[model samples]
Target: MRCQPPLKSMVYNWLNNNHACLLCDEPAEQPYPLCVACEAELPWLDDGCQTCALPLPMQGLTCAECRRRPPAFYRVEAPWHYGFPLDALISRFKYNSQWPLGNLLAQLLGRWLNHRYNEDLPRPTLLLPVPLSRRRLRQRGYNQAAMLARWLSGHTGIACNEQVLTRLLDTAAQQGLSARERQRNLHQAFSVTTSAPIEGRHVALIDDVLTTGATAQALASLLLKAGARRVDIYCLARTAKPGSA
Candidate 1:
């Protein structure tokens, strides 16, 4: 396919996802959309715990939470933290009704996944996003995590299990919950809706962010119960602070 003209980038973006932010309705840009400043100020989640991907200190190795109880999703890969540009960007994408950003973020995540997992990382037979409750889906009009999984499937050769896992619980938001609290809040929140036999197969759980890994951990348990041999999380952003998780 030929490249689109620079002037039509915004228009193309709009056409791709109703021409709005994935989380918000603010005007977006071409391809990735969102304003330039928002792109620049994106809270890139750098230097986090390799396993949990929670922002870590330069000296100490692991956070108290990870040390006490490690996350269940094997390892995490996030491009940004859940703050600043990413927070605002995700705000527009999630709350503001900007849906295209979901695809954009997915592409970013796919790029990273390809680089990290293609060579040595265990490849997943399927990509399943942590599902959003119907209420949240109705309120938000879309599931951002699902969109990320779709994008990953499109780019990588991994199969997309759109309905493999379902969010059975409509628990409270995890914004301020402690790691333990978050785990408790999400405990038994998810169940497998479609039991695709994954006996000895690897699976990747896609999500927009990995706050405390509780959600991912909970989902992993369910997927494992369903015979998924391994579970890895593919998240767009991770918190850049230990306490944040």
Candidate 2:
């Protein structure tokens, strides 16, 4: 027999009377990890390239690189820029395996996406987290992108299929790679797991951060090749170089 748990957790918060801010030690304002002031002070990406989510001086403009050689994905939306305490928080959440931090980050991302839903943007039918190689998955014990996607799925009622897309190779870390180098490294690194009908579906690719966008481009290319009509990217933050504009 199969037992299905309720959509919402039945457990009550008896551990602490108030939820402490993840950035500061102060009490947070309802459901978020940061207090109102800290939230306001976050490095929000108010202006960026719509195509790739790279931070820019002006809004609603595509970068030169994107204009020349556009990414496989149509657009990307991220709430914050990868900087300062934000980077530190993500490091603790990702590399350190701090579930609470990851949860908090995911919650913020959900809120941002929900706000976008209220606007003009439409939600994707399927949410696919950028997959990790099996070797990396075993070494890390979990895929942070999957964790965030699942959390977002539960809240937004969007179906998340982590098994749909996969990493076929253990590519080198993309942190220090140039754009061309990263693209080369990600070649043949991702693949689709099933021959399911993805035709004409809008798929949202979720990830922790958008940097260089090599991985997202590779995954988006694969999804498009598998028959997806359009691919959109959603990430918590974007890392644009100082003078990359």
Candidate 3:
């Protein structure tokens, strides 16, 4: 559903004959059709705040803001910061309609999981991706986070539950909003569905990135209200300002 339905090799070849990468308008390559040069330009953040993984000034545990008010979600993990080559990786997965990229990104997230929580990461019975608004779903044809969640569930042996956490209220993007503003914007944005309500169950949430943890926090609170015993987050990227935003 994310692409031009399914096409035979011949049909795909025909379509590719004249088409170019939308971002670079150059002759496209395989699958995503992004050229080699553009592929290498993904901006990967090295060091970042421990809480949100946002690029930081130096080594530190959690940002001051997060320390004062911890998020509802238990923990956040992301392989790369949402910048440069990493940002492009997300773009190719998002705008260029490269759905398979989710699989690779999810693999990276899984590795991060094993690396950090090797000793004691509680394996949840269900993996849930944060949901998108109906309007956004109609426009994008896919939920990138859902795709990644499916991938993580596949590799981790956890059942994927797409219906547990529902996005009832459509929200404005929180890219530049302050922490307080972000929380206010995302307040009550999510609720557990009537069917398959997670009462006294553990859940692992998947997403492409974690910024203010506002959305995740709100969702976690809803899950807690619905009786989820524990909620953890696994993300492809974590963006903490440490004050950077």
Question: Largest lDDT belongs to which candidate?
Answer: 2
Clashes of each: 19, 0, 11
Candidate 1: where is the Cα deviation over 4 Å? 1-41, 58-61, 242-245
lDDT, residue 182, candidate 2? 95
Residue 32, candidate 3: how far off, in angstroms? Answer: 14
- Give the TM-score of each candidate: 0.78, 0.91, 0.75
**Per-residue error (Å), model 2, residue 78:** 0.4
Error at 224, model 1, angstroms: 1.6
lDDT of 1 at 233: 81
Every candidate's lDDT:
0.72, 0.84, 0.70
Candidate 2: the clashing residue pairs are none
lDDT of 1 by residue, 35-82 (tens): 555555567665777677778755235666667877666777687778
> What digit string (tens of lDDT, one per residue) describes model 3 on residues 66-148?
68877666766566677655666677887767654555566656655666657676667888889998988988888988888
Cα misplacement distance, residue 3 of candidate 1 (Å)? 30
Using alpha carbons, what is the TM-score of model 1? 0.78
